[model samples]
Target: MRAELVVIGAGPAGLAASLAAAARGTRVVLVDAATETGGQFYRQPAAGLRAGRPEALHHRWRTWERLRDGLAASSVRVLTDHHVWCVERTSVGFTVHALLGPEQEEPAEVHARAVLLATGGYEHVLPFPGWTLPGVVTAGGAQAMLKGALAVPGRRAVVAGTGPLLLPVATGLAAAGVEVVALVESTGPGRLARRGRALAGKLPEGAGYAARLLRHRVPVLARHTVVRAHGDDRLTGVTVAALDTDGRVRPGTERQLPCDTLAVGHGMLPHTDLAEGLGCGLDGLAVAVDAEQRTDVPGVWAAGESTGIGGAALALAEGHIAGCSAAAHLRGTAPGPAPAALKARTRLRRSAAALDAAYAPPAHWPEQVTDDTVVCRCEAVTAGAVRDALGLGAGDERTVKLLTRAGMGWCQGRMCQAAVAGLTGCPPTPSRRPLARPVPLGVLARQHTQEELS
Candidate 1:
């Protein structure tokens, strides 16, 4: 496929960017790895499930429908089930390499004059004693299972986390008829009260979830953290404790909650693999973009969680601006002013900044992590091993990885990067990988021979 613009995601940002550009007569190719359009935020149940009320799972159903319907009317070409592995700069523009289908062995390529990366972020997994168990999953993972598959992670569940995400996940699970044992939050309500001004716009949404939780009779335990998950083959319960003002777990506050599932998450990190591969500068693990959402690399733009972890509203605003700028650039013209979206972007960004300040993980979370607790699931490295590695003058994550193989696993440190940095007391840095995802050896051989250039 060849296009004037290539949008590398199907989420709110990608959808908005593609529509905005194509509306201006620019041909765009919107590709995604998922079988459907919406990314995690707007995840819909699988079509085969025959969900009676798919929109019930989402908040902005009209917006998603508008984006979906707009694509059919625009010059945007949509490609599903295409996983982009690598992108190479060509003399004219660039070539995007992708693997097609469920097997991900067939090669597919798209040539584009300009590329927009709306690649979303992933949940930050904080490891606990029994996190590797079957019934233990990330907060987003549990939501995905419910939204995408229309299935609950478990009948009895404990939604434990520090971020604002726990509010929705708990309410959603309860709404789905799951028995929510408790919502354990690490941050105290006082901090949220102090930041009341910034949370004004979110009041209605938060109130709605609060109403749902109350209706479901779910207990909201503030200033609480999950010290450990308890289970043998699967999650049967979790140990919850109260955090002091300094974030240390208060002694004698520990209690056991019986539940079949533990859905916990601290927060999210931007997905910047391709951004780092293309030499884009990062602002604290997120892709750095200018006022127009243009990256340091020419002919490339990034929005959404790749730039920051704001909600769909911010992503849409950024995507609209980026699309308008890219459209004008491709046409040898300057971008027209977009006052509304700019204002929206500014407001949403302020809200996002406040969220970052308000929902930070517990200060003494590392103190609760025991020596025997597993930090790196793939390498099976324990906290004791990481502490020992740190004691051996392994000051950085790379040095620790070299000493303990903590990040040299299949995920290449995506799952354990935050935990390793937290445990090592070092800032997390992005790793540069040439390919965004793993590729089969056969695909490489065929590409080298240029025999399957289709």
Candidate 2:
């Protein structure tokens, strides 16, 4: 398929971008791995589920509906179940390669004058013992399950994490009839209070969550962390403890919370594998983009969580700005003023920055991991293994991976990137590779033949 723009996610960012560009007379292709377009944030029940009220679990439901309607009303070609694996620049534009089914044997390609990456992020999980057991899921995973599958993680659960996401996840689970034992936040309340000015702006919404927690009589444990999960096959309980100022567990702060499930998370990281593979410069964990959301590479742009781990609102604002900028660039027209959009982007950016600073992980978090703590759940690599690798003078993530096989798994390094980086005492470096996701050999051969013929 040929178009003026190809957007690689169906979330709020990609949906907004495709709509904006299409409205400006640009033929756009909005592709996603999901069978639906809401992404993780606005995940809905599958069409076959016949859910009674899908909007109840979601915040900003009207905005999502508006975007969905706009997408339906526009000329954008929406391709679901299309998992983009690679993107290559062409003389005229760019070629995007995707695997288009469950088996992923089918090959699909899009030719576009420009590409926008709204590929959203995944949850950052710091694993402990028994985390691999059933009923132990990330905070976002639990939310996704509730939002998309219309199922609860378990009958009783504890939401433990170090970010603003814990509030919504716990409240959503509680409201969905799941008994939430507690909301354990690793970051102390004092830190939140210290960021007074930033917290002030987001008060009403925060107050709403507080009120919900109070009404539900859910215990909120600030400055506490889940030291370990206890279970045989599934989660039976969790050991929680209050952390000292240095984030180490206080000797006498240990307590056990009886819960069938543990919904835990550290935070989120940018999903920049595709952008990095395309040789785009990164600003820390995010794809480095100009004010217009153009990456260092020509004909390639990125917005949303691929640029940074901002929430849906910021992603939408960035997507709108990126769409307008990309359309203008493709049309050879000087960029015109989008004053309202620019202001919205500015406000959202400020909010995202504040959230980032406030939810910054504890400095001494790594000290909490004992030798038995599983850091890389995929490979069953424990903290001791990583520490052993570090003790042997492993200099970087690559060396650590080679020595301990910490990141060699189905997820690559997505789940263990932060842990490995911290363990190795190396700067968080970007991973650049040829393909974003694994593709069948036959599909690769076909794409190669097609490329040669073209």
Candidate 3:
């Protein structure tokens, strides 16, 4: 089907964008890989699960309800379970290719004059020993299980990570009746306090999470990290160690935290595969966007975590702004006198920037990896191999790829990009490619035939 605007990812960003554009008299189609509208932030119970008070697990329930209502009321065609694989520019506008089904074997496409990518970020996991065990999951993944499936990770859990998300996940697990043994944060209290001014202005509710953790009596181990996870078939315990100022594990400071589940996450990186495939310019790990949230490429825009790893609030603001901008451009209207939507976008952008700087990952984090620690789970690449490549003078990410083949797997480096970059001693680089995901040869042949016929 063709639409005036196609918003990829039905999360807060896409939902807000579609509703805003549809309200501005634009035909919109919102597509998502999941079965529901909310992205990771507002994940809901499955259709069959008759859980009362699903909002009890969520933070901003009212805002989500408003967006949900707007989507239902607007002239937006919502397509769930649409895993977009490739997007190509056409003579008229753009063509989005997707695979739709539980198995992702069915083909689907959406033609639109403009496209807004709201593809969200994924958890950045640095693997330790026994991470491959059954019970070790990312911090976000644990939240997804609890919020979406209404299931806890285990009876006892250890939440280890360096981010604001640790607090909620720890407290939530505790609230779910799981005994949270420890909340291990690698970033020191001094660093957190240093960023306090910026963080405070961005998220005033930050203190609320702290209060909740204190009330729950969860042990907050600052300046500590999970050095190794211990288990046979499932997580039995994890070796948590104090870190020096440089993020190196202090010898003889290791203490084992007994838990059945180890919920660990470093942070998040923006999902820019689709955007990078389209040759969109990137600012560090994020897609570079203009004031209007428009990419350098015409007829293409991006919002939410695809642009950067901000929380849902920033995403909502960016989506609203992008929708209005795209709608205005489509109608050939002058972009003047910022509307309420534009003002909100401005506010959100400021807030997102502050938070981004505040919660930035600790420098020298790669030093935490021991020689035995696995860096890439897909290829089973270890820290020693990466370090060897670096010692051999692998100057860039591409050279590191040649030396170690760290990014050649099916995930295409989504699982290992951050670690590889840190080990290679360089900034993260943008990955450019022709297709976002592996395409079926038959689909490509058919598309070419149709083009020739036309």
Candidate 3 Cα outliers beyond 4 Å, as residue runs = 202-204, 335-348, 360-362, 391-393
lDDT of 2 by residue, 304-360 (tens): 888888788888988888888888888898667778767877777777787787775
Q: Could you report the Cα RMSD, in angstroms, for every candidate shown?
A: 1.5, 1.4, 2.1
lDDT tens digits, residue span 75-139, model 1: 88999999999888888988889999999999999999999999999899787777787899999
Regions of model 1 farther than 4 Å from truth: 451-454
If ranked by lDDT, best first, what sequence of candidates would result? 1, 2, 3
Better of 1 and 2 by TM-score: 1
Residue 13, candidate 2: alpha-carbon lDDT: 86
Q: Pick the candidate with the highest lDDT.
A: 1
Q: Per-residue error at 53 for model 1, in Å?
A: 0.5
Extract clashing residue pairs from model 3: none
Clashing pairs in 2: none
TM per model?
0.98, 0.97, 0.94
Best by the TM-score measure: 1
Which 10 residues in a row give candidate 2 its minimum summed lDDT?
360-369
